[model samples]
Target: MQTSPKPKLLIFDVNGTLLNMDGIKTAINQAYQHPGAFTQWFSWLLQYSLVDTVTKTYHPFSEIAEAALQMTAASLKVNVDAVFMQDILKSMQQLPPHPDILTGLDLLKKAGYKMVTLTNSASAAQKKQLEFAQLNAYFEETFSVDAVELYKPHPKTYQYVLDELNFDPQETMLIAAHGWDVAGAARAGLQTAFIARDGQALYPLAKKPEFVCADLHELAVQLAAL
Candidate 1:
């Protein structure tokens, strides 16, 4: 438990951290004609996100979603239309929060921690997801890497949020369920809290998070204690 001095701003990753997107995984598989198609698409989505980031090419997350789906479909030897792909993405916007998210975020807000979301999704899409989960009001701001034309694991993307909020890296903590995101923030010189959702392993290339918890409520309690 490496506790930093009290944090002035808390930046959170949207997907997997606060929101429960398991349903979206089901929806994607159902939309595609394969059992593991959703997983393949998601993996490729990450690959493409990194490619776009490293190449300095920008694409909306929605576009990445579509491309990944198409590539996955191709790999599976199936064909899908743009309209069907759009449906899959629209379904993503309807995902609900994890069971403990609302109560936890409310508690943190009351504790005077400034909460903001930093996501890879586009601003409109991110807003729709948060709004659907009823988690929007708890946040001071919602940010998307789309504005910076890059994605996470890129140091520049994490830096963009700090720059936009006028926050010092040391004063802001990036909380996320994804280990790569934790790594990226750490590289950018921000403290990190890892919410261990889905039992994903930590990144080998990056420093471990300052705090690791089972979920957002546990993290909220820890942050409040600080």
Candidate 2:
């Protein structure tokens, strides 16, 4: 059997993958006083992003997020104002990285891999997230779909990164907590690693990625073996 080569460019998915979402999750749940508010809001955010992408229309991720928040509140018959919703979302900009993230990135960096981020957030939000998490310096660059005005799991979103870095699909690997994101990269001909974060799973029907690890630290250890 032919051996698969090691990846050169390591693209990371932010949000639940690298940064823990508990901070904002707590805020949303508390604001609504609803047990499942965070889950519902997040699902709506993702669903509508795809909706916009499929329709070839675009909205900033924050706008979609707030819309989701409002819709969730409406569904529950709870009152919410735009100002409060925006304040709740401001927590997203300051989310902290997971404990394992720094350790994992250090191992990857020492192993001579180039790292970057690909996120659904707007460019400004992405920058603030990285800076607030103190992870900006670890990455060579970061990408936001805001440029293409298309969210992830879209083939073009992955293509944009490949084009920007001039790396062939096979030479790069996308690491994400979302099964759909991993599937998208696989479809785009890139290598992939599925980070099995809490409450996340791979799509059963999609092609399996080359690696599936329990956490970023575990993924780093596995990749270092290569």
Best by lDDT: 2
Candidate achieving the largest TM-score: 2
lDDT of each: 0.85, 0.92
Lowest lDDT sum, 10 consecutive residues, model 1, at 26-35
Give a tens-digit lDDT track for model 1, residues 1-226. Answer: 5667777899989888888879878867886767788779988998998998788788888889889988988888876788888888898898888997887887799899998999999999998998898887898888888887889978888788788889899998999888888998999999998888775668987887888888888888877777
Model 2 misses residue 212 by how many Å? Answer: 0.7
The residue-level lDDT of candidate 1 at 109 comes to 92
Please provide, for model 2 over 1-226, each residue's C-alpha lDDT reduced to its tens digit, 9 standing for 90 to 100. Answer: 1156899999999999999998888878888889899999999999999999999999999999989998999998888777889887798998889889999999999998999999999989999999999998889999999999999999999999999999999999999999999999999999999999888999988878999989899999888878
TM-score of each: 0.94, 0.97
Once fitted onto the true fold, the runs of candidate 2 whose alpha carbons sit more than 4 angstroms away are 1-3
User: lDDT score, residue 91, model 2?
Assistant: 84
Error of 1 at 171 (Å): 1.2
